[model samples]
Target chain A: MMRVLVVLAVVFATLPGVIVVLASLTAGQSLAFPPQGLSLRWYEVIFADPDFRDALLTSLTLATITSLLAVSLSALAAISIVRYRSRATALIEAMLLSPLAVPHIVIGIGILQLYGYFGLRADLLTLTLGHLIITIPFALRMLITSLAGMDRQIEHAAASLGATPRAILFQVILPQMKMGLLGAAISVFILSFDDVALTVFLVQPGYTTVPIMLFGMAENQVLPSIHAASVILLLASWLGVILIDRLIGFDRFLFRDGPSG
Target chain B: MQVAPAIRSSRLSRRATSLLLLAPTTLLYLTVYLGGLVMVLVMSIDVPPGVDSGGATLAHYRDVFGSAPIGAIVLRTLRDSLATVAGCLLLGVPVARYITASASRWKGIVLMAVLSPLMVSAIGRIFGWIALFGPGSVIADGLTALFGGKPTGLLYTEAAIIIGLTNLLLPFMVLSVASSRAHFEEDMSKAALSLGATPLSVLLQVELPLIFPGILSGALIVFSLSTTNFVTAALLGGSGRDLVGYEIYLDILVYFQQGRGAALAMLLLVVVVALMALAIQTGVQRHEVRDTAARTRGT
Candidate 1:
């Protein structure tokens, strides 16, 4: 009975993804599972469409910049959280994770208002800020988790050898946190890449992310090309998960609660 | 115990450097993130210019809560959130136990499989459901053939929303359960079995109590996550439903009702924060227990 339930759980978990892969292969104009005939025609169509092309570029670029910023900023904050023993450190840690407590839809519109008040256009910068607000928490949490379990002996050894702070940081601390850094980088990039709620209100029409664009298309009409778009995203996310498992080990990182907490 | 090498610099300079290290993150979080949050709260109560006399009123809250449909919407949101969490816990506990008990290399592969829905965007996975629940799809078609009735009512319903949210949340639930089991592994169960207790009794009496906190926090997390999501509820659930998430989206973008949207957003924020506080408090309590234990040992 126990084994049966685990099998069932795994099956249900991947069922939607499997259905998507099958649906995307359809030769039909509209979306449907169990395609009439398997074809790559829809994939070709989605790639040709400038909107999908631009949205893909915009999403990747936004994710890249957001993850880069999130990793560095959170690395600094994680040092404070792990290294220091100050009252303010706890406050900072709590505040950094505060965004996870609130709903993303609220943050999305709040960001819209923030930019609107300052007369800032809803472009890449605004989108990056929105993603940053969401992604920073994950980056901070991952680094904090990594730093917490780390042994301090190596840092002490380096300092006792008269190594400079910069050397110890670059060569000792960072190299130790490599897996954590990569995991943070991958998680933040994926979260920022696939964000829809934050992207929806913070995006300009032509400069929107892929999820936002796909959402609009999903809302307006059903198309097999959207399935193709989804299949590509699913594939991309699968690659990230695989990389996470290889680089750091998914069992180590992912068992912590998701960024939702 | 600072990680950086302590230089022989003056006290004030060390303080300044500490401030410098902390300043960037503090400034960004406060100015950009918290500032937006405050803006939303301000917009919620202070009615936009054209709507009313506009003197820091609770009129938006009064307007939102006074309406009958809003009440119904809140109830529906609650129902869906509860149902989704229930579904996730039902499925998640067994899987988490399986992962925790097994020492095989393939357990990592299984963990990845569990998180597949979560790592995939809600939009991507939900679109797949649009296919799965769509007419003439395999599941729908299979049902139609067997039952000899129209294959409908599943798509664009609360059922679909619940299923989508449950799948998205199952990984978290599994992780939480797995985390609790990590500290108390197979030893307890083995000890209980050695005492001649039945397998069923050992699981119920020995293990369930240990992992109950995990289940509680996981349920709360799922409740909070599923309730606040707009995209999954919107696309999978048709526009006819007045989900708080979808309604807030329409309120802000469609009707240009910023005040009401902000009010609704704040309400959702309050509920989500309260649940998260409980969840974190559970975690913090355990950490405090460990800290006190270490302190006692040191003394």
Candidate 2:
């Protein structure tokens, strides 16, 4: 009985992805499961549409810049909290992690109102700021975990060998934190890439992310081409998951008190 | 706590370095995220310029809490969210136990399989449902053939919303349960079995108690997420159903009623936070009771 339930749950979890992938290959014009016939026509159609291409580029560029900033800013904060103990460290960490407690829809509405009151244009910069607010917590947590687990003896050993602080940091510390850095970067990238609720509010005309575009299209009518676009995103996220598993061990990453805490 | 002599020589510099490293994140979080949250609270009560002498008003709050239609929407949202929580817990516990009991190699693969849904965006995940259950699809066609009636589809139904939310949130429940079980020792269960306890009795009387905290926390998370989730409820439940998140979206964007929307958002935030606080309080009390029981047993 237990085994049956597990198997059934697994199927329920994965069947949606399987059907979407299969249905995206439909030779038919509209979206439907059990494809009328198999063909690559929809994929070709989506690729030819410059709007999909532009949205993809915008998502990529936004994700790239957002992740880079999130990682750098988080690394600095993580280093300070880990290396230097002070009365304010706990408060600082809590404040940084507070964003995760709020729902995404609330954040979207809040930022929308904030921008409206301040007369700030809803553009790429405003979108990046919103993305940064969400992504920074993940990056900061990963780096803090990595830094907390590091051996202080190594830094002491380097200092004893007449190495300067800069040399010790650049050569000894960063090399040891490779996996943490990579995981944090990938996490922020994936999060910023696929964000919909927050992105929808901040997006302007002709400046939408792929998920938002797919959302708008799906709301009115779902063409088979939407499935094709979804497949591309599915593949991208799948690649990120595999990369994290290879670099950081999926079991360790999943079980850690990371985002779900 | 002995420091290296070379590092100890520059105490002031170390303090400066720490301050420099901490400043940017603090500044950014405060200016944007925290600031926006405060602005939303203010907007929730702000009276429009032409309405009633321009002082702060509770009219939006009154509408949110007092209106019949809005009250029904709130009740519906709570019902659906609770149903989603039930679905997640039902499916999640068995899967978590399976992952925890499996061997090392299988554990990695199983964990990945469980978490794979989270990798796909909610849009992509919902698209799969759209294909599988939309009109003229295989399931609808088969149902129509069997029943000799109108074609039956799950799209835009309450069941679809619950199912989608459960699938999307199962990973969170599983991860929570699995992590809490990570440090659990099997010897206690083994000893219970050796003392003439049946397997079912052992599971119910012993293991369940040990993992109850996990279930509680997981349910709290799943419930909060289910309530606040906009995309899944909106896409699957349709506009006519009107969950609070969707209602807020329409009020702000479609209807241009910012004050009411802000009021609803703040109300949702308060309910979620209060529930979390209540859960934590109960969890702490439970821990103290358990600790006292253990102490008594020791004596």
Which numbered prediction scores highest in DockQ against the true structure?
Answer: 1
Off by over 4 Å in 2: A257-261, B1-12, B146-149, B276-299
lDDT of 2: 0.82
Note the residue pairs that clash in candidate 2.
none
TM-score of each: 0.93, 0.93
Alpha-carbon lDDT, every model: 0.82, 0.82
lDDT of 1 by residue, B224-290 (tens): 9988888888888877775898899999998888889899999999989999999877666545543
Relative to the real complex, the DockQ score for model 1 comes to 0.57
| Candidate 1: tens digits of C-alpha lDDT, residues A134-159 | 98888888898888889999999999
- Residue B53 displacement in candidate 2 (angstroms): 1.4
Q: TM-score of chain B only, all predictions?
A: 0.88, 0.87
lDDT score for residue A230 of model 2: 86
lDDT of 2 by residue, A33-123 (tens): 8888999999999999998899999899999999999998998899888888676767888888777667778788888878888898766
